[model samples]
Target chain A: MASETDYVTLISKDGFSYVVQRSSARISPVLKRMLDPTGAFLEAKDNTCILQDMPGIVLEKVCEYFYYNEKNKDARDVPEMDIPTELCLELLMASDYLDI
Target chain B: MSGRRGGNRIRGPQSALTDFLAANNISAAQIRDDYERRRQQAEQDAADAGEGPSNQTPEQNDDEALAAAAQAEEAEKKTKKRKRTEKDAIDKIKNAKATKKGKGKKKGKKDEEDDEDGDDDADYDDDFGMYKKARPAPGQFEHCDICNKRFTVTPYSKEGPDGGLLCTPCGKELSKDVKKEQKAATKSAGTGRKRRKVESDRLDGIAVGGAKSLSQLCIQKVAQHHDDIEELGDLPPSVLERLSEIFSKKRVMKSKTLPLFLRPDLDSVIVHDAAYLEEEDYRQIFAIVPNVRKLVLSNTCQLKDGAIDYMLERCHDLRHIQLYAANLVSEGMWHRVFREAGGKLECLKLSWLDAAFEDLVVQDMVKYCPKLERLKLKLCRRLGEDAVTSISDLPELKHLSLQISQNVSTPVLVNLVEKRGSGLQTLSLEKFIDADDSVVGAIHDNCIQLSKLRLSENDTVTDAGYTALFTDWDNPPLKFADFNSTRDIDNNNSGGPEDAIGLASSGFRALMEHSGASLRHLHIASCRHIELSAFMDVFNGAQNYPALEYINMSFCNRADTSVVAGIFKSCPALKQLVAFGCFDVQDVVVPRNVALIGVPRAQDAIEQFGIGIGVDEAISRMVEVTT
Candidate 1:
């Protein structure tokens, strides 16, 4: 699960950087810019972004899926699961933080 | 501005006076002083010239006094001439009627009365008091201040002291004191005259006497002939007490159908509640006055079924009829009104009616209201492309509101905009459903002067529509680098940018990419999900749209702070952004350009941090955030 300490670096289109934590990013959607495909790595670039509320584990999973989705160009829908209410809240927080 | 007076379109002396008055914002006292000075100067000039200003010599020392006397004499002569004309016409009609009715029944009653009245006229010449008494009573003389004509009273004022007293002219001209004395004398001598007049009246009957005398009477005679004329004008002192009692009892029912006293500038009485008038009431009301020029109906009068026929029958002089919320306005009603009074109606507002009847009625309305300039049919659900298309054909139509929910689809609207673009300045489509890119494009292309466009709840329209509408169509180049790039891409790239990779996957995107900076207001309410690519095509590559002062991205599911960051970085002057119900709302990243952010206390979720990020801070940022 994501914790408050996890952070992400966001770069604006003009190449400015802003440091944001996962807990703070969980309430904002700008953090989703980190999921954009550049090359092979998840290195921050010159783009707009914030942070995410998802646990560090969930953030890694989402990034992993984002990577594969970009590579394969997948359009598959996310499957429904019996997710705990707290985890669902964490997902919404992450979605909110990423603004996606 | 010069206007017509006395049947002639001549520039009045007042026009020059107005010019003088307006030239220097002259005060009334100053104008009066100037006028007096001019008059005195004219007098001095007359004195200096000696042979003296043509008509007036120095012998007429009181030139003003002389002029006034001459003018009074001339006015008196003209009044006498007018009185003769009126009296001759009336006498002729009265004699004709008297002869016609009293052909065989000439027991010589009315003839005897006339001889007595003639003798009384002679007596009026001698005593002047007797002449006044012999003149028609105060109520007996009827004159219209409007037409400046006289009408004989039906029963005559035989009951008062001034029975057969003042001639219509004299009664209108005489001082109140002289009139009162004449009234007193006529009452004193009323005995024999009243008897003879009543005897003749009984024999001739009210109707026959009325017709003979009425031919000499213009519409003003109706006021004298009204039921309360005798009760009002020459009522005895004792009768006044009874009248007040009667008035108090019947106050509600006694409301005037059309007020008798009219403002001088208003030439006609506009009966406001004509449509709601009962049949008998309409007949009585119209029968009372024959010179009404305009009648406007009030409220949403349910024409029911037969009311239109009844209204048409009685309202003969009605030039304009406004049926705002009438029920039962069918094709037949439209045809009937048009056929009856179409030549005079200048304005027609018939918006609230059954939709099924609107088109047919509108067609007939246009055909009939030849002088019509304003037609308002807002929310007439029955009106469709046929009505809209036809309405565009009217040359005089200046305003129209075709706000019906229908397939007022692109083609019909485009045709309308093209046809009536210049003439139709105000067109409202408040609840229009089929307003799309093509419709907006046509409006932008053809309707150059259209200032207000109301497409309030129309959700089908996208941002591309605005892009196409606001961007100048003449600027896009046919051969471009993007075009070549798009064509060179693999055929299998389904999701790749089509030749129009700028906005909305159409020429609209190209237009926005080139000129999205021109958009002043962009409303994307209920546009489902916001597309990141479309947003980029508009705000990313373009700089001019500046930051929109107002952005209504309400109810859009995909609104995120990244979009906000883009807006902040690009649009430096954004004043108001209404993203209500935008589920994806996050803390907006304040751009560094604005040194300080004025975040509201209510938006506690947003926090500020100082600028500057060290290289060491970059590597541990992700790990620090993940903790």
Candidate 2:
């Protein structure tokens, strides 16, 4: 299934909205945990406030990666995303902040 | 004020609170005496209660009750003793306030004095703070966060389950776990480690120490000094950040003593000090860096047995290898090296390994390195007919040098000619002893692109062989199968050439009629004899092949100065000539256009001509010969 068809919606802090599939958002464990407290209808308003360093494009891609892999989690390991050098730095810092 | 007292009671130690007040120079002796009196009155009350006989004169119950009431009154008096004390609390507070005011005034005066002193005290305080912030000395470490122990390293590690300052040892252990996990991840993802090998013939000829044992010892040493191998340690923050930026570009330099045979990119590396490496050292070096392309391992005697497999497994980009002194390895060295490094190798130099003279080693080398263009085995006595025959299959081979290797026979050279043919551009078989007619025939028949043919010190080559070899087959259009008819073909411009043909068609006979004039540099020095008919072939030719650049005919007794003079006249394009110790060539016959050099200077001239440079040690010799 397409990542967009799986997740219903993804709202970014910069006010950019993504009507994504549920499976796409579940790609990342952090996003999955975030959805745990707030179900499908709950707004992931924290992306605007919590993730200080994650850029819009990276967040979108990360969400897309998670959405696709969520359905086949048992069969496949997490895909190693070949991120650009600058974004890798950003991810490390951001992940460290989230205590991931 | 009530809360302040409670705060003071909690903050200050009980003994220190009393001591601080007393040592302030305030008089509190009366309070102390009043407390002591109250303590004695309590002791008397306790004794009266224990024994009623002491107050028998009074009504027993009434007396006891009165005594109790009296004791209570005394306790009340002691409890209320602070109110009656002459040391008034108001007076004490006034005195403390006055002293505090005095101290404040003293501090203000000191401040004015400090300003007059150029504010040195203020600057000193700030400097002290800055000095503390900056690292003052090695021992004065900023305390660790995890262990709370004063360590040189600052707090960076995450708190363990048991919260303590993370020390260096703990950090190292954590990092090792991270690395091991990383390796496991990669491995689980189906990526495996690689190995490398060195392409050298077995060095059993030199009888060096055991290859297997030596390598094991080297690995033992590496294991023993494993802690010392600190490729990854506590790097400074800036350096660590930079390293993580381009993690793929990281290179590992094991050591100068250890030669890595198995590396991923083994082909492109040039190792200068891996000559005496043991096998274990070779394995260790290969275990890390697996892929390289251009390898130059000079000494092979020091490497151990299974190390070659390491090179083969790891290095995919390997191409050229310049090996020096590879004669100290065990037997089956070539088989191992070829099994690993055979296909991709194009250029190889094994000139310095004089002890690698085994026949099977040479055959195995030829079986591998099929695309070899340049094969230099100079002075390697172990090289025999097998080595030459093995190379015959290599179609792309251009240069073949077996100089001073006594084991190489004439038949081997013949085989090379028959197989490689016109592809053989440069052939150096100098100082060969058993060069017969079959050898000469091979050169005559197959060496069409033969520019430089050095057939030095072979006594078997006669005058007939000389004339048969030197005559150009392509230019003169003369086939020397009929030696008599071809000899006259140069003489008669008028004759039906088909009718004039006589002798049998032999490749050796063609050499006697001077059928190889396309030859540039000919080293026929120290030959046995040269036929008179061969001498005529040189004189008869006016227009020689344009490519014949250099010629060496030193120490030929049969041909005289006439041979040299004839060469000068016929081959006008000859640039260099060596005729030393020939005794046949007169000094007057020396050509001014061609430089004259001794036997040793020939190599120098060739080097200059090959590279098209003017650096020549032979130039001096030419000048001296002219002067």
Name the top lDDT candidate.
2
Q: What ranges in model 1 sit over 4 Å off?
A: A1-100, B1-352, B368-376, B396-400, B405-414, B422-445, B454-471, B474-522, B536-550, B562-576, B588-627
User: What digit string (tens of lDDT, one per residue) describes model 2 on residues B217-243?
Assistant: 222333334334433233233322332
Candidate 1's displacement at residue A80, Å, is 52
- In candidate 1, position B565 carries an lDDT of 49
lDDT of each: 0.45, 0.48
Q: Which stretch of 10 consecutive residues in model 2 chain B shows the poorest summed lDDT?
A: B195-204
TM-score of each: 0.32, 0.35
Q: Residue B172 lDDT in model 1?
A: 50
User: Can you list each candidate's DockQ?
Assistant: 0.00, 0.02
Off by over 4 Å in 2: A1-100, B1-310, B352-357, B366-399, B402-432, B442-452, B469-519, B528-548, B557-575, B582-595, B598-627
